[model samples]
Target chain A: MQVSVKYFASLRELMGEASSVIDIEENISVSELWQSILESKKVVFDNVMMAVNMEYVKSEHQLKSGDEVAFFPPVTGG
Target chain B: MLIEIRKEAFNAYAEMQYYLDELDIDGQYGATASFVGTMRDFNEDKNITSLTLEYYPGMTEKHLETIVNGAIEKWNLLDVLILHRVGKIKIAEDIVLVATWSAHRKDAFESCRVIMEQLKSGAPFWKKEETTTGVKWVEKNTPGF
Candidate 1:
């Protein structure tokens, strides 16, 4: 399956890109996705939070094709 | 009616005037209160050059709406607006705009307090300061829910 992912703040800078489309296996969990990305890239969004399809979802939330996955660093805005 | 997140901003006078105009409507709201948060050049003795504020796009918007709506539910307010700025903001820049309209001073005051307090804690925004020495994240002595 394929999905879109977004990176923000430190995560974006670390990833060296804002977003990208990638291919993954079916029913991939958030943590599993993190491992896969690490294997292919030099990005560290380790402590960051993620959301799937616009909702603040936990990493364990199962992902499907075409979902827009976002990763955010520890929040600071007010 | 405008809840914007911008990279640059002017003084909060315009939003104040805008709210005043709305609240001044006859028999609409008895009182209105406003506050403008500015970026101080010095945060606890740091000669900050600039501030880079980062926010979670979808979550930040949702959190702001939920907070403002919560305030409205608790207070008898007529209207409200919240504006927050992001990106590289210089010292002395206008950081935030908050406004409230209510039936009386009490509601206006309460709503303003709640909104401001919630922003400090709940809004999913982080600040990194570029100071004379180097860049550092602003520490939160008190965390919020």
Candidate 2:
């Protein structure tokens, strides 16, 4: 299964790419996918907000094929 | 209700007037409360030139709609408007405008404030500042108490 991963704001700068697609095992949790990605790049972000298909979700949320996942820092808009 | 995310700056008063005039409320609203946020020249004690705002496109509009609809239901508001700027914005320029209309001042005032507070904390917009030294992303927002 493949899912599209997106990074925004500071995360985008650190990731060096706005978005990418990765193949993953079925029913992987959001945190597991993030850990795998970060470990490969030697980067760490302790306070990340996660979203699946544009809706905010917990780290333990399960992923599915064709999901649009987003990771970003805490919001700072007015 | 009207929700807008624009790359250009806008006048809060004019936007509010235009939106309110178009509504067919038939003099149903007795109070209108609004809040306008502007860019400041300094942050973290450093002088700043301008800032760029980034968002998640479709997700941003959805989140804002949820916030506005929640406020309207919670306070029974008659009308609401929210406008936020994106891309580069100079210091002292308007960054956002939130206005609410209700039958009384209490509902209008409270709903307007609640919407702003929720938007500040929950919205997916990110701000990157151009300071005197260099550019940096804002990690957190000021407490909305």
Candidate 3:
């Protein structure tokens, strides 16, 4: 399965890129995907928010092929 | 209801006037409550020179619509308008505008407040601040209203 990952705000700076497409095994959860991605970065998972297909989802949410996943810091807009 | 996310600067008074004259909800609405959020010169004790806002284009609009609908469902609202700026924004410039119209003052006031609060925490917009020190992404804890 291919998942499109997006980083925003501080996460984009930390990731050094805006978005990427990664190949993953079937039935992987969002948390598992993050754990793999975070291994190469210096970022922590604290206070982070995630969304699948633009809707807020929990870490335990299951992923499917061609899903758009986004991660960002807490929102600060009014 | 109107929801717009754009980079162009807007005049709140002019926008409101145009909306009022065009929508003509004055006959049904006795009160209109509005809130405007502007970029501040300072944040976290640092002097902010400019601010840049980003969003998930399609999703941001969808979430805003959901919030507006929620407010309308909870209150007896005649109309609502939400305008948010994206991309580069300077200090003292308008960042967001939320307005609600209702037959009574209480409904308009409460719905306006709820929409702003929900938009702050629920919307998919992110802001980066440029200060004398450097550019930093603001870290915000969701506030309970």
Candidate 4:
């Protein structure tokens, strides 16, 4: 399966790209997908938030084909 | 309800007038409560020069709509409007506007406050503060209700 990943705000600055599409194995959780992309255990996953298809989701949420996964920092807008 | 995310600045009075003119209130609404959030010159003991707001294109609107709907369900509101700015904003410029109209002052006031509070922590928008020294992403300290 394949999914589109998006980075926003500070995460976008750190990632250097707004969005990208990547192939992934079927039924992988959001955490696994993120780990696979960054290949880093140093990242504090608890500090970040994830959204699937524009709705908030847990890191353990399962992903499906063509899902749009977004990772961003906590909101600070009013 | 009106929800917009724009790069250009807007006149709050004009927008309110337009909304009132278009809606058939028929003297049903007794009060209108509004809140405007502006860019400040200082934050966290830093001399802030400007702020750049970024949002998730599709998700931001959805979250805002959900918030407005929740407020309507919780209160006896006749109308609601939310306008947020994106891109670079200078100090003292309007960054967000939230307004609510209801037949009673209590409902209008409570709904307005709830909407603003929800928008602050629930919406998928981020603020980058530019100080005299450099730019930094603001850390979220306030918890969402």
Candidate 5:
């Protein structure tokens, strides 16, 4: 399976890219995918917010093919 | 319920008037509550010149719709008009407008606050300010409470 991942705000700056499409094994959780990305990028973040397919999701949520996953810093809008 | 993400500046008063005129919900609303947030020229002791706002396009719309829907249900609102700006914004420019209408003042006022607070803390929008020293991404928003 494959998913499109996106980084926003400060996370985008840290990740050094806006978005990417990556192949992933089946039954992969959101946290696992994030860990893999962090490991590969050699970056560390204490926390982040995640969304799957445009909706907020728990880290334990499983990924699916064609899912648009987003990770971003805390929001600051009014 | 109306939710919009704008890439350019907007006048809140004119927008509210136009929205009311278009919807024509005249007799139903006895009270109209609104909150407009503007960019400040200074932040954290830095003189800010402008700001660059960013958001997740599809997800931002969806999240705003959800916020509006929740407010409508909780307050039994007659209507809601929300407009948020993205892209570059100058100092003292209007960044967001949230207006709520209801038969009574309490619901209108409370729901408007709720919506704004929720948006401040939860919405996908992010702001990077052009400060005197350098540009910086806002780490967090003020507490909603």
Candidate 6:
């Protein structure tokens, strides 16, 4: 399955891409998918928030194909 | 009720005036209050430098909308507008624009305050400041935002 991941703030600076499409193993949970991202993009993994379908989610949640995953840094704006 | 989140900068006086007139300002409205948040040159013993802002494109907008709706429900507000800038921003630049109109001055101030407070602890946008020393994440007054 193919999923698009978006990087924001420091994560974007680290990943060097605003968004990317990757093919992952089928039936992967959110936790496993994040682990893969860490393996490939450790810098972003260090400081980021995970979101699926525009909603913040925990690692145990299951991800569906073509989900728009986003990684955001800490809160900044007032 | 109106909500806008974008990367481009906005003129404070122009945006505020235009929105007020467009929303059909209530002549009885005793007060209209605004809370403008700007990018400070320094933070927590850090020297002045540049500021970069980021946000969840989809989630940010959605959350902002919900917040606006909440304010509408709770206050007798005539108008409310939230303008946020994305991408790179400079020091002392206007970062966020929030305005509220109501039948009374107190309501406007209270509503605007509530929106900004909730936005700080609830919005999905994040900021990072880059200085000669190094870059660091911006922290909020309230934890777990």
True contacts kept of each: 0.51, 0.88, 0.78, 0.82, 0.92, 0.65
Task: Give me the overall lDDT of model 6.
Answer: 0.79
iRMSD in angstroms, per model: 2.5, 0.6, 1.2, 1.0, 0.6, 1.9
Chain B vs. true chain B: TM-score per candidate:
0.89, 0.97, 0.96, 0.93, 0.97, 0.90
Tens-digit per-residue lDDT, B1-145, candidate 4: 9999989877766777787889898689999999988889988899999999999999999999999999989999999989999999988888889989999999999999989998997899899999999999997846645
Per-residue lDDT over A25-75 for candidate 3, one digit per residue giving the tens place of the 0 to 100 score: 998999899888898675676777889998989999999999999988888
Residue pairs in steric clash, candidate 5? none
- For TM-score, candidate 2 versus 5, the one ahead is 2
Position B104, candidate 4: lDDT: 93
Higher-lDDT candidate of 2 and 6: 2
Stretches of candidate 2 above 4 Å error? none
Estimate TM-scores for all models.
Answer: 0.81, 0.98, 0.94, 0.93, 0.97, 0.81
Cα lDDT tens digits, model 1, A1-78, are: 999998776767778899999898998897688778877885555567777776667768899999988876766665
Give the alpha carbon lDDT tens digit for every residue of A1-74 in model 6: 89998877666767788999989888887778778887876643544567899877887778788999877676
Better candidate by TM-score, 3 or 5: 5
lDDT score, candidate 3: 0.88
Number of the top-ranking candidate, with TM-score as the measure: 2
Model 5 lDDT per residue over A1-78, tens place: 889999999999999999999999999999999999999999998769999999999999999999999999998876
Candidate 5, residues B1-145, lDDT tens digits: the string is: 7899999899888998999998867788899999999889987889999999999999999998898888877887889999999999998789999999999999999999999998988889999999888999988887767
- Writing each residue's lDDT as its tens digit, candidate 2 over B35-124 gives 999999998898999999999899999999999988877897999999999999998889999999999999999999999999999889
Give DockQ per model, in order: 0.44, 0.91, 0.75, 0.81, 0.91, 0.53
DockQ of 3: 0.75
Clashes of 3: 0
Per-residue lDDT of model 6, residues B1-145, tens digit only? 6678767777766788888777665676778889888777777878858877777767988888888899889888887889988888877778888998888888898889989988887688888788879988775545422
